[model samples]
Target: MKNLKLLKWILILAALGLFAILAARAYLAHRAAPLGPWHTHVPNELTAAELARSDWTGYLEVESAIFTELEMAVTRQLDPADRVPANRYFDGSPLYPGRFAQDWNRSFVLDPDGPPVGAVVLLHGLTDSPYSLRNIARRYREHGYVAVAIRLPGHGTVPGGLTVVDWEDWTAATQLAVREARRRAGPGTPLHLVGYSQGGALAMKYALDAIDDPDLPQAERIVLISPMIGITAFARFAGLLGLPAIFPAFANAAWIGVLPEFNPFKYNSFPVNAARQSSLLSRLLQRRLARAAQDGRLDALPPILTFQSIVDFTVSTRAIVDSLYARLPANGSELVLFDLNRSVKFGPLLHFGGDLDPARLLPAAPRAYRTTLVTNAEADRREVVARVIPAGETTERIDRLGLQYPSTVFSLSHVALPFPSNDPLYGLEPDEAEDFGIRLGALSLRGERGALIVGADMLIRMSSNPFFPYLLDRIEEGIDSSASGRSGIDRDRL
Candidate 1:
């Protein structure tokens, strides 16, 4: 009897352990789950006296509330079927010439005025707010720039509000922030724009639009981190699934994406209106590209620094590549496409095509611009030749090499490029892989004539996290070589 009781207790304990493990896994997957194309960063607000009086716990509490509020707004917005609209957190009304505006603006900065060397205007991703860019803004402030993270209209509220605001409104908001940055920076001080994900594309769009704006202040440079100027396969899939408009507001299908480890909240995949708005904006961007070519605006585009990762699952490489070739001015733009090996993998599988097992899909072998051109006459009597080029160097190289090669590069699945943090191949530790972000940032900042560094973190995140010793070694070697007069091959490739 005693032995039986002991055995029963053991069984109970084992069951409890299994349950705990399952719970932990669920939480991790939920937190790390990608909200497709969602992305973020911040500063020390305490004065010398306050710093002495307050503990880190107090600061964490305050930050926690801020994050909580931001998440609540985003979450509520994502649940499109919700009965009511989410309240707006930001007031973007033009500051009237009144005492109220002055009073509000005075207390806005979390600190006493610090002498700014310049001004930095930050743009957050779509469906996100200034909250996402807060971390990076704080960094800029630490570096002596007056960092301003603007809340785009219709954002930080209900997702439905977003549908009302068009891409032009987004462009105008960026322009407004740039103007404010310029005005605040005073004479001769440079203005820098940093855009994350969708914000990056908007920043690029603004640069193109303001290329000749006489009233605008001189934009010193631009930084694009994981910019989303093109559409992803999931986005196409969403369209193929017959536009979210056909589904109920609360209907949220499962989506697999790259989730930043820093994000603390779960994401909602519904919000059909948000998807529709995204689709519209994407079409508008295509129209803009066509118009830019027709109007000859591409040649006048401003200098830009762009960063992207090969494994980023949200924004595909095709968008970045297309933007680089079509929008960037010939001589002043820099593009960095970080590579991701297939061996690196993230778990929590999501399969498309309804019940199609993923394992059976078999990871396609890495192909280097294999091309196939087919010519056919349609029933409508239109003759067309379509060329499919898979993602590879030859297609990319051909762009710089000029349009002598095929126009289309085989599309990389959107989520495939920015592989999530949960990817099995990613290794975060204290070793040679230690400081890729700092290295990339330094290299980008230290370039000839001080070129802009677009979301250099995107590349660093995808490359360094997986602990690619060879890449890390090359980075260090490049830094050392550049210090001298010797040119580094890896640096050129990067």
Candidate 2:
């Protein structure tokens, strides 16, 4: 009778614990910012079948319809005072002034002056519009390559669009972009795929898909910037956090972060479902990569060039090394790692001792792929050097670069790898000639907390690369070598 009484007490405690957790979640939901029109009114999710049937024109039509609906929803929901300056949906706002009149958020195609000799399809990252890759696309255009930068579905419209879309929809959109690129370049032209962040995963997956399907257009070369090969394990269970969203009382539980829409090109507000979708995509890609490696199908993959930071807060650098690069079949793949700034002033504070050295991640000798490290020449100087290790070789060649690490900057972030040093929005030294209303990178905000719309973390994150010139030079070198009937860096050198 005593044991039975103890069991009853345990059951009571367990029920109370569950109740307390639910009550806390409900309270937090109630305290959250009220759902805006973009959050409450979900957009149509694109399916693979629909994307396959639609051409670029049909795709644009569907996008226009969604944007129109979003505009109407915003009109009905927000007051005139709340709508004008802060909301991007409204015209004549400082965030999106009527300088262009037409929306610059959509996908764009840039053609060369002459007939295209090569074709390049550029895919932007998650929560980013095609504007992110405009610089690279222009470079490709100047080189006589037809560049197609597609604004992935669920993006460039509203943040709510991402809440409904899945990774399959993203891959389907990639297919459409490739088809358009193929048509523009015609046959016998070198086709390349360039992807940033999440788009990098799509590009890698598409390459894998091409290996299985003979009809798909094969990419001759692949470029990835801060690829999302793996993300945090928390993202795997992010969907569970949104379970309360099923009840209208706790609808705010669906959002991971709700912030003001300040950036014209990217979404500041992030939803829990978006994180879940990205995690699903990364998991699927990892599985496919592993299966392909085991079946020897990865041997058919084209040359891949990747640029990544030694320390990335979003994705795992170790995963990129162990999962992708380690499995590659020496098909002229190269990984360029930007090491942390080990300046003399910050040397003591920096963790230099431990296993933080990225070079240690590689095998003892004769690595299958080439590795390049952009790092400081010594412990005391700000000058940077390029340490290149040729494929299947142990010897390292150190070359001094004219470039010097900026004293103000300590390290590059994942988002910094793509944009140049002179970008109007994110550059450290923003171009004054071009104005994006707000020069985010140049802001030296010094005020009490809560005064800003966005958190301090958003401003603290590094957004532009100082060594972007070297990155562009390396890319152009590869392009020039390819045009001369050679594959990437001379195999003889390797």
* Per-residue lDDT over 10-92 for candidate 2, one digit per residue giving the tens place of the 0 to 100 score: 99998898667666766788788787776666767468789977777777788778767766676456766657666665666
Considering summed lDDT, which 10 consecutive residues are worst modelled in model 1?
401-410
- Over 122-176, each residue of candidate 1 has an lDDT whose tens digit, in order, gives 8877666554454456555655567766655445433333433455656666666
How close is every model to the real structure, measured as TM-score?
0.46, 0.92
Q: What is the lDDT of residue 238 in candidate 2?
A: 84
Best by TM-score: 2
Prediction-by-prediction clash tally? 18, 0
Candidate 2: lDDT over CA atoms? 0.83
Off by over 4 Å in 1: 1-114, 157-165, 233-267, 342-494
Give model 2's TM-score versus the native structure: 0.92
lDDT by candidate, in order shown = 0.42, 0.83
